[model samples]
Target: MALTPPAWRHTLTEVPRGAAGVLRLAGKWRAMATGPRGRGEPVMVLPGLFNSDRSNVALRRHLTRMGYRVEGWGLGRNLGQRAIGQDGERLFARIDAMAERYGAPISLVGISLGGLMARIAAHRMPGHVAQVVTISSPFAGPPDATRVWRAYQALSGARIDDPEVRALVGEAGRPLSVPTTAIWSASDGLVGGAICRGEDCAAVEVRSSHVWVQFNPDVLRAVAVALAT
Candidate 1:
């Protein structure tokens, strides 16, 4: 079973209130030091909901340097909806093409809604995906745990109670057949940490903001390690 709000929120909410700025600066410094070295199989980095390919450029660059062929979803922007299956199908097709081009299984590194999409793709096409990594993704529940999330859902025409959303979340509860890792922060101001847990998946806890997860050193390290495996 997943943790309750009181149990998880206390840990996740404390950092954003106090040391967020410091962490952000540290994250940037780490990115500069890590530089680009590049190694593993090809990787697809997907941005969060409402985000664009540019949003994940730094992370993708780092992964490229780490010896991995990194690519971003060419989708224009993320608009939160349960019909994400359409986008997932397109992304899967892209992954298939990349696999053919690279001649190796692809690892998916996704944030927020993109993570859910990656999970769906991996579940449906295990032979094509080698591993999956997610940051601040709500795998086990809706994203609208807070009032701000509720507001965003309403503004974006995303129905939190939509049947499709419920089904997606439900699918997340089952054990993933592919190797999976989830990187979460104690400072995510968006989705509750309770929804980040996985039964058989390796979960790494870090200190970073929800918005800047892709830039955090700890989160990046966790993703790199997961992909390396």
Candidate 2:
């Protein structure tokens, strides 16, 4: 079972704390110092809700330097359900196209809501997706566990408590056919880390703020290692 959701205090203080974390990116740069090259395989990076591919730019750059062919989701800004409506067939088609382009399975690294989407894609198309890595994504609990649920509902026009939404979230939490890794943070200011885990995937814990998790150097290194394997 997933752990209890974090209290409102943590969620409320997220932005300033996360900004501080973002400012510390320079330190992470110094720490990571060098990049370890990968097998030059195809990797796709998906951004979180309300964010576009731009959010994964830093992570993508790091992966590219590591000799991996990383690309963004390309379906425009992630306005949650609004991007693909409810069915998500369009997103699936995009994943299929990326797989066909390389003629090989693709590894996915997604942040926040993107991670859940990646998990769903992997579950649906194991042949196309070789591995999955999620950073600060809530896969094990209700959507309401996230402090940003209101924003999601406002932007996506989907109610979190809806039975269909709950069912879908539950399905994404199940084991996936591909190798999976979930990178979570106890200090996450937005969604609680407890809900970011999956039973089938190995879980790696990090110290990062929610907004900065994608850009944090440690998280980047973890993602690189997952991609390499």
Candidate 3:
């Protein structure tokens, strides 16, 4: 028999909280400069599934104020397999160009599905990527464990269980030569907390919903700490 679906009550609560977080970002935009900064090394921020670079505006602004040269993947919207395009040649090319521009390996900070992309990129070209940090990314469970699976299918027209998707999902648990940090949240509405923890990843926990994690103060602090390491 199929198991009963988990309660998504918390997920529903995220709607208002996410909106509030966006407002908080607008008010505190300038204060971001007061925090600790990075080495001005290149940091590329990738958005979650169905998200465009616009969703990461607050994150990029904070990171930029922290003295890091950060850029978003210019790709319009993240479309699962389609975003990678033709064996991920387009994505790889982006990584390669960043590394070349900086004259050193680049750090990647990805949210949700974007996190999975970062991990794969790091593994594929460890020489180009310095480290990877994933926020609210499910690394220890199947794709179905995520609340967005159905929405993902609806938006991308790709089966969550397809062979290629399965292979990419499996890569989440595999360790990479470059440093990796998985920042998860117990309050995440979309992804279960347990599945976000990966055996091969250095884990950090935050108290925020999956949607607002990108703008959560604690999450921002953790991302900085991860990149500074």
Q: Return the top candidate by lDDT.
A: 2
For model 2, the run of ten residues with the poorest summed lDDT: 79-88
| Model 3 TM-score (2 dp) | 0.91
Q: Write the per-residue lDDT of candidate 1 for residues 92-171, one digit (tens) a residue.
A: 68888988889988888888777877787788788888888988887866555532356547545756677776676666
- The lDDT of model 2 is 0.83
Q: What shift in Å separates residue 153 of candidate 3 from its native position after superposition?
A: 1.0
Off by over 4 Å in 2: 1-3, 30-35, 83-87
lDDT value, residue 190 of candidate 1: 67
Steric clash pairs (candidate 1): 12-186, 37-65, 38-65, 38-66, 38-67, 39-66, 39-67, 39-68
Badly placed stretches (over 4 Å) of model 1 are 1-40, 146-148
For candidate 2, the per-residue lDDT at 170 reads 78
Mark the 10 consecutive residues where model 3 has the least summed lDDT: 1-10
Which scores greater on TM-score, model 1 or model 3? 3
lDDT of 1: 0.71
Give every collision pair in model 3.
none
lDDT of 3 by residue, 1-229 (tens): 3322234886888878676766776676566556566879899999998899998887887788788999998887998878663448888899999999989999999998899889888888889999999988876678787788899888878898888778887875577788888998777788877777676778998877787679876677788788877
The candidates, ranked best first by lDDT, are 2, 3, 1
Candidate 3 has an lDDT of 0.81
Model 1 has a clash total of 8
> lDDT per model, in order?
0.71, 0.83, 0.81
